[model samples]
Target: MNESSDLQRFQELIEASAERELTEVETAFIGRMGFRSEQCRQWLEADAEVVAAAVEQDPLRTVPAATTLDWARVDAGLRRAGALPDSRAQSRNAWPLLPAAAALLLCIGVINAILRDGLSTTPQAPPEVVAEVLDLPEGDGSLILHEGDDEGVLMIILSNG
Candidate 1:
């Protein structure tokens, strides 16, 4: 066989050895080529190193054991960091007064609304002086005329003595 055909066969055997175990004839071919060529000897040495490393390595690592947690320590740490309220101290009383303040504000708003409504009414247009009538007695007398709160209602008083 030619030198190229021998080298090709050697490469095929090396590739096949990676996938599966080689037959005795194939192994003998590899050995003969390894002895004959320096390149083949280097390839054989690399393959041997890879196989040795794989064989020496452990497949699975041993896991650590499970441990229990102490909740009291966690709580103490949280309290020290001010993340939790102290059980011994009383909470602020301001929450109770919130409702009272809200009620007072509501009352003030209601009173303001009532006053605004009371003042909002436009004054009656001076009773629209449609006409005026004057009657004078022969002697001393007096007359007073004015509009009442009710629309179109008028009050008049006359006194003579």
Candidate 2:
């Protein structure tokens, strides 16, 4: 058979083997394919058990029913027990501190900006140059360099200025 048909037949054989025993043709094919018959059969049986267990223990089927809530009654009980604060009074009491906290933050920011600006604006000293001069030999003579040429030496004259 063609390769694809062989694969399909192989799959069918495996599925049938998991359900029951292999047919004569399947047994021959498995032997030809070099499968260890006992181990292969055991693997197929284990796979079938895993699939069956997975189907039997589906997550959606095992989920508990959700508990219901009564939010209105809970809120009423908390209010009667005075456990919840009055929102308006809390907000009113908190307002007076806001401007003080904002002013302190603003002061800190201004101080940081001033310090950064001052550091960047500080004057730096200019670098000084010191030259080292070497004394030349006492002579009224000129220096000559002989470059590779048929011509004679090139003369360099020295001046005190």
Candidate 3:
């Protein structure tokens, strides 16, 4: 048979083997053909480590493990692209209240300055001085008068005379 006919027969035999209906003659024929192939001999002579590396790698499990997306990097990129603000920018944006706080402090300082100037400009007068004279019970003691304050108001004291 030609090569194409041989390949068609090989595919039909593979399909029959997959269906679990290949006869012993078909199995012996396929085994004989595989034994005669140079590719089959090379596969049998392949390094153990290379065969292990190729066989142990499962694309279903390893593909997802190798290609997982990093969520933190994605979030940072979103922030940089202006899709969302990070916590640091949010805190910085809250600084608009500083001017109001400074205004309040300025008003307090102005009120304090006005009250100080108002108090310092006026003169405080001394209280009115009143005097009382008293006599001691003992006879033969003298009464003394002393002045108090810068205004020279008299304070009377009585002793036995």
Candidate 1: residue 144 Cα off by (Å) = 99
For model 2, residues 8-93, the per-residue Cα lDDT tens digits are 56667766888898878877986554353444455446668778888888987677754445665676578677887665567556
Task: List runs of model 1 lying over 4 Å from the truth.
Answer: 42-161
Query: lDDT of candidate 1 vs native?
Result: 0.58
Question: Can you tell me which runs of candidate 2 are displaced by over 4 Å?
Answer: 34-161
Q: In each prediction, how many residue pairs overlap at the backbone (N, C-alpha, C within less than 3 A)?
A: 0, 0, 5
Q: Is candidate 2 or candidate 3 better by lDDT?
A: 3
Candidate 3: segments with Cα more than 4 A from true spot: 37-54, 57-161
TM-score of 2: 0.21
Residue 26 shift from truth in candidate 3, angstroms: 0.8
How many steric overlaps does candidate 3 have? 5
State the weakest 10-residue window (summed lDDT) of model 3: 131-140
Candidate 2's clash total is 0
Give candidate 3's root-mean-square deviation (CA, Å): 28.2
Ranking by lDDT: 1, 3, 2
Order of models, best TM-score first: 1, 3, 2
